[model samples]
Target chain A: MNRMILYKEWLKTRWFLLAAFLVLAAGTFYMGLSLSKTVQFNGADKLWEVLVSKETVLLETLKYLPLAVGGLLAVVQFFPETARKRLKLTLHLPYPQGRMMAMMYGYGLAALTILFLLQATVLTVSLRHYFVTELVVRIMVTAAVWYLAGYAAYIWVAAVCLEPTWRMRVVVIVLLAALVRLLFLSGVPESYNGILPWLVLYVLCGQVLIFHSVARFKEGLQD
Target chain B: MKKIGKIFIGLSLALLVLWLVPWVYRIVTLESYSTPFTLYSCVVHDFTSLDRSDARNFRFIDRKGNVYGDEVQPLFYHSILASKGAFPDSLEGIPVTEEMVEHNSVILSAEPKEFNVKKAPVYLLMESVPVRLELHDPEDAFVVRKNGLAVYRMADNTLLEEKTGRFNAALSAEGFRFPANLVAGKPSHHKEYDEGYLLTDAEGKLFHLKQVDGEPVVRHFPAADSLDLRQILITEFTNRATLGYLVDRDNRLHMLRPDGTVIPTEVRYDPAREDLLVVGDLFYYTVKTSDADGEHFFALRSDDFSLVDRMDRPYDFEEEVNLCKYVFPCRLSFTSSDDGWVKPRFSDFSWIGLVVDLLVAVFIIAWRWRRKNTNN
Candidate 1:
């Protein structure tokens, strides 16, 4: 459960991390180099020109690197081998199985946090050469917000994938994501007055699902 | 299995219908381009040669091709015609003078004199009829071009020339009658007329042609609307090999070609080598010049007149040109160099940039996956 042990384990996989960072860095660098000559870099402060200008929003969307990385992290967390290891460890561990799983989820969150910090440091250092004063804060804030979104995804993945019923958890996770997005767009805003209670009901169901997964994990260890 | 699957299928169908319904309704109810406009008069400036750097020193050419440097006022007097075919009876009086105390609205009555002084009082008739024109009161002057071709109302109700020996005086339109009360006059010299008469097409193509055979003829392409350009100065017209020339109104010079093309003097002078620039909804392209030693210039689209990129500039243009917003009174042109071409440089990142992204993506995935596996 030690945070230090989790950090050391993540550090051991530095080679793989280096490769992923290279892919993102190359793409971002290409963008910066291409944009340096255009109005996007030079005319960022011109309100009308920037707002109506082409490629302005496209360049802004590139800053959502963290969210992409987080989705991939979710897939990796759900790998079958990891599920087997968790089940085996719970049987022998003296601590309660649910507590152990919670600790693992915390460990996954810490890894994502470190990845975000690394990305922030790299982006800041690279932007220094451009010397564009107006866009520095916007770019930094964009990176931070997207990284936070990635962390939220990590939390959802950790809670779902540790359950004994892996296939069921996957189906539920996808359906829930889809439903929330739909309800947020249609049910809530279409003057559907009954949507609030339904939303609360959905949240309650989510809580019960997590409680059921924890109970199943403890029972699986006992069996 | 049967009931749950059927429910899922129904839900999917409902969602698809919900999404497509709005789009279908939008297509059915959408109206095509329809913008309404009321007829009004605005005194536009007549420019001969604009230096962009100086407004006061702009050399204004007259209809007779003589250039003069002086300050001319723009007076806009415009109102909706009360009746379409009826001659305007409002302008059926002698122009206000010092002796006419009743006619003088605010200023005291002065001596009735010919328009011979340095700054002459001039007026513009927006929509002209044979008898009456939408005349602006004498007090409301100088929003339109003051030192150019002007039509004012005379006491006799017949349109007369305020200046002697200019050009065709007997020219008339068959369907449209000359408003009787309107009188045509010039400010001081023929060069002042060159500063006023200008033509802008539906595609934002601006042309200021010199009045040859009395008035500059405006022939709109495809369905050409032949409007006699009241005041304009044609500086250069090369029809042989290159069908392009620069025309001036007061001081503003616009570069135009025969094939429905207009490149504003401002865009030809932009510092950045952008592929395109937008003015209102219309787009103007930035491109290199055709001649061996020409610089980067702009060319508008022939059909619908969107921007089309030409080439880059050979020389490094000044940065001050970027501040122009059509509000500033300056001589502007988007010029390009045909001699040399420079490719856009992209050197913001090295090998490190690639390494960073890959590392970051891999690290997050590997770390999270490992944690998930070990915990389970």
Candidate 2:
């Protein structure tokens, strides 16, 4: 039954996932090309000097890509189910309702983790050619927060869509906005290093919020 | 499940209200003010200020509230005064020239944020005695690792084994340990000269490393081994009387001299919290340290680090009534004025505001109850 639910989620999101992967690949390719062009023009020493002295990550253009993909993935996966009231039918199945909801959320989260890993792998492989291990790690560590923000966005958006009433959805959104703002508070590379563990815990705690909205929907709290 | 959801949502709402409301209040009540530029004048023998507090009228005033109109220009702006043929012959009974003032003048500023931020371990070691008499960026950079120092050729990102071996041997001969705690240097070629880097080894021993020509000049200070050194800044001022400044674990400031002598200064400075600015001339060094409360000024004799004078100026806020204390239970901020790192910081809890918060809760419940009764 869990396998069937996971398959259903995959079927719903396969095309959107493909598009997101392609878009992310294109962005990574563009960044690589731009970095190569700079190295060719000014030599790699100048690039290294700038990276050492300046507060730039060089992967800034791709910062918001993960966020957009995460938010949109949530919309693609959940909006139709809620809009057509198909979730009510799904919840009425013989399977335990709590396990069913967990399976659905777990599917979405697992898919996002795999997708984000691929993006990070591509970045790591390309960055290694031009930068030292320390420099490469600095860029990756800085980009880690954005990827976490993506996960947080996906979870929060799912909760918002699953919410039963309009007033409560607005409240969830305001809270989510403030929470998201916390993830992007600093542009200084690796400035999030000290607080990253707590932020990860915060994102993990947010997973329960989706269950909150589902519980509301089960209570028939409609607007 | 329903009860947990309600509790979670309630807690989130409370956290948001506590964080955002005070933030919004601060933003809405923001005001603009500038600290007057203060400098101690050797000729006037008092602190002078350029007060542009009023946007329209600018005043140059001495500590005694005496305005000198434009006559004070020569005291601070010696170059401009010399260009206009108004430069004084002597200051404080000592004959002065434009070259003397220009060479002797040094402004050293150290902010807490600069020390707080993360820095790459790589360092550029410029040749102290360049062939063309002007400094140029070195072809390689070095990193201090647990094993020893590793030098990398910057052009192709390759290791320079020969140079690295030479430096490692030089440092080892001086009894320097592997893995430096702090490395400070003025790396830019725009400076008058390069002082290489001031490093504290793993055991808190001070070692000065510089490249004269193509070899390493390593000097280890055994005297610094007893002190718990926190930070060292290499200053390459044209005067060359002092090598750099050092901050010990107790937050006391010391001046590093050319003869390898560390002299404690009378200036009280906290390098991790306050901003320290030192404006030095031929006669005196005016050190200013500023924090949230106010700015503290110390004038020290140039020869001996004796305190010549001291003054304090408290900051004034435009808002007469601070609503933050009465309206906000606590405040949340991600960034701080003291450091460049972005991390969550919750501060300034007002126990007085809890009463207000309780009253607000009662009022909200009463209003909701009254509305429900009317509807029924």
Candidate 3:
């Protein structure tokens, strides 16, 4: 039954997952290629020096790609389902509603994780070919918060979708926006370095927000 | 379980409101007042302020009612001239000249380095091009790791095995241990010559580090046993003034000379909050430090670190907010001007918010109890 639910969720998200992957891949490649052209013009040594002294993270263009992809993925997968009350039909299945909801969200999350890892791996490999391990890690660590913001977006957008009224959704969205802003508070590279593990925990705990929305939805608190 | 989740969300929303409302109100209504740009003068035996609090208006005056450059250029130019010995008869009748001020002037600043938010300690060592103070294209950059255990070049991201080995060996030869405490340097092309970095070893000993001809040059400086050194700043001044100032564990400032010696200055350091500016002329080294308590100006002679004159002014600037603070006596701010961190830090505390919270709580409980009694 969970497998069937997972299949249903995949049916909704598979195309978005592909598009998100390609967009991120293209962005990563463009940045790496730009760095290559720069190095060709002014040797790798100068580039490394600027990164060290100025804390310049060369992959700034790619910073918002994951965030945009995550939020869009959530909207694509859940909005239509909740729009026509399709979730009501799914709830009537013999499978427990909680398990069914978990299966659906879990599948979407797993797919996003795979996409982000793909993006991370491709960028890290390309960066390593030119720069050293320390710079490579610094770039990756700086991207950690933006990537986690993807999961937060997914979970929060799911809550907004589960909400049964426009008034509640507006308030919830404002709160979600404030929450998202927290993830991007500092553009200083690696400002999020030591705080990442706890941030991950905070994002994971945010999963409960959607469960609360689901409970409220089942209570039929409609506008 | 569902009820608990709902309550958790409610509490979080409340906390967010608690943090936001007061901060927003204060931001919208608060008026700002700051003291003038002040510097100490040994010649005048008081603080000299360039007061420009009013827009498009400025006055240069001593605390003793002496004024300078009333109609044209400010008296600051005259002070600068005196400090540099250009003005034979200074406004305050001090004996100074250009040559004496050029060689003797030094700046000792002690603004604590805030590492609350970590940045990659990556530095670009610009090539020493022909012109001094001219920024050069970087040939390489470097980061010291694990207490100077290794120095890796950033270009190809490889260890400059020979340079690293030389530095490590030199420090070991100097009887210093691994994992240095503090490493300070200014690696830009904007200086006369690079002093490289000042490293304090694991056991709190001082050493100088510089790169010459792509080689590591290390010099060990015998330090005072009570040094408890915390931070260092390296200035590549034209006069090759003292290497830089160091802040010790006891919140005291010291100067490190070029020949690897230390002089404990009379300046007090407030690690919590310290803003210091040191100006040097041929005759006196004027140091100004400002903090919550007030502004302190001290002038010490260039030859010996003896207090020539001192000024202590009490700045109770917070009293300006006493009337309007009833609206917000305290605010929970995640980030502070002092450091770069987004953690819950309560600031601007007063008795106002406490009384308000207690009163609000009492009213709520009383209303709930009254409702229960009416139902019974």
Q: What interface-residue Cα RMSD does candidate 3 give after superposition?
A: 2.5
**Error in Å for residue B254 of model 2:** 0.9
Q: Per-residue lDDT tens digits of candidate 2, residues A57-138?
A: 8899999898888888998898888999999999899999889988988888888899899999989989888777778898
For candidate 3, lDDT tens digit of each residue in B140-201? 55565665655655556677778667767877887777777777777766555667778787
Listed per prediction, chain B TM-scores read 0.20, 0.90, 0.82
Model 2 DockQ vs. reference: 0.63
Q: What is the per-residue lDDT of model 2 for residues B49-89, given as tens digits with 9 covering 90 to 100?
A: 88776435556778898875434645457866777788989
Q: What digit string (tens of lDDT, one per residue) describes model 1 on residues A1-223?
A: 4554355445544554555467566766776666454535444223212321221322454544655565556446444324556445544667655455555555555666676676567666655443232233434643443455465445445446645666646654664464434332321011222233443343333433434555555556321
Q: Which numbered prediction scores highest in TM-score against the true structure?
A: 2
Q: Is candidate 1 or candidate 2 better by lDDT?
A: 2
Question: How do these models rank on TM-score, best leading?
Answer: 2, 3, 1
- TM-score of the first chain of model 2: 0.98
| Per-model DockQ | 0.01, 0.63, 0.47
User: What TM-score does prediction 1 earn?
Assistant: 0.32
Worst 10 residues of 3 chain A by lDDT: A47-56
TM values, all candidates: 0.32, 0.94, 0.88
Q: What are the RMSD figures for all models against the true structure? A: 27.1, 2.5, 3.7
Model 1 agreement with the true structure over B177-215: per-residue lDDT tens digits: 222211222211222122222333333333322233323
TM-score of chain A of 1: 0.60
